[model samples]
Target: MNTITDTSIESITIEAADPDATREFLAAAFGLGGRIRVRRSEAPTTGFRGFTVSLIVAQPSTVHSLVGTALAAGAVEIKPVAKSMWGVGGTVQAPDGTVWKVATSAKKDTGPATREVEKVVILLGAEDVGASKRFYLDRGFTVDKSFGSYVEFETPGSPIGLGLYRRRALAKDAGVDESGSGSHRVVISGPAGTDPDGFAWEPNPSEQ
Candidate 1:
């Protein structure tokens, strides 16, 4: 009955000649205005030399607009930004060719499970899990489970989960190599009684 497989867009990577300049410009233009992590990477001896990848808080409803504006300003659009039926997302590419994507989330709670799930978790992969944990923890994220190769942040009233893990393992899980360095975007949905899937909110008491 199903023909297409694996339709969700998880992550992406891009190459930039001047990663720092591009990062600063993008952060300002997109109003990311959050704690950003910068890492120096080598290899892929073609497009990138020294670069920075920024991970910002993303919500599903406005993820597309956030990325679209940045891409339109200075970032190049590699993949056409779009949303999915299950309320996930895929928006990648930025100026300097740095890749960024809005976070994608799981399907609706179709089971008899009531109680109204308010949020979802987002997971990311990093080379140094410990360092990354400290980085996020310093930025006001409530860190949990510090023994494994991964770390998670519990953000409620969202559709996607927020987490970080080992880059090699993350790439392996996604069937990709972890040698390249670039920005990635992710989106999480909003709480109930709100526009979880829809956007452009006003004072809509009827929808609420």
Candidate 2:
């Protein structure tokens, strides 16, 4: 059995065909902080095939603002802003092929939710949901919710929620090609500082 430790995603590294452009888009759209690292890659990227980076906001207004910002930054809208079972949300694809979902929970609805951003979720599209679920479970992530082909896990003291979804299905939902190839442009970290399931880890230089 693998011992679990307090873990959190340190950063998500995106290998973009045009790193500077990708970085500018992200900054303009989401005001991406130091947590996101963008690097140039000559190697072809399959684009956002099997993953979504979600921004959880405190209110519906923020969701609208984020969606608009993404569009202004050259993102293609996959889903327009609308009310869903969870709350009001929308989806967009970044120029670098990264899919982003901006949403807020209905529970926070109180005569107009505030515009404060809450959390970020990195949802990974796994070739095998069960295998990916187990990989994180063994590494000490506690399951928050689980259903067929979908699972959500939360790390201790980490605001980010990691999720696993069926790859082809996720790609279909994002309105993107189901082809899974090239660098995934993602990174996860934890207190253990150990790589599981062949995931790479780069310690935060500032934290060191």
- Every candidate's lDDT: 0.42, 0.73
For candidate 1, the 10 contiguous residues with the lowest summed lDDT are: 192-201
Candidate 2 has what TM-score? 0.83
Clashes of each: 18, 0
Best by lDDT: 2
> What value of lDDT does candidate 2 attain over all alpha carbons?
0.73
Off by over 4 Å in 1: 1-24, 27-29, 34-61, 82-86, 96-98, 104-150, 154-162, 169-177, 181-208
Model 2 agreement with the true structure over 124-154: per-residue lDDT tens digits: 8777788777777776678889888888886
Report clash pairs, candidate 2.
none
lDDT of 2 at 189: 48
Task: Work out how many backbone clashes candidate 1 has.
Answer: 18
What does candidate 1 score in Cα RMSD to the true structure?
15.8
| 138 Cα displacement, candidate 1 (Å) | 14
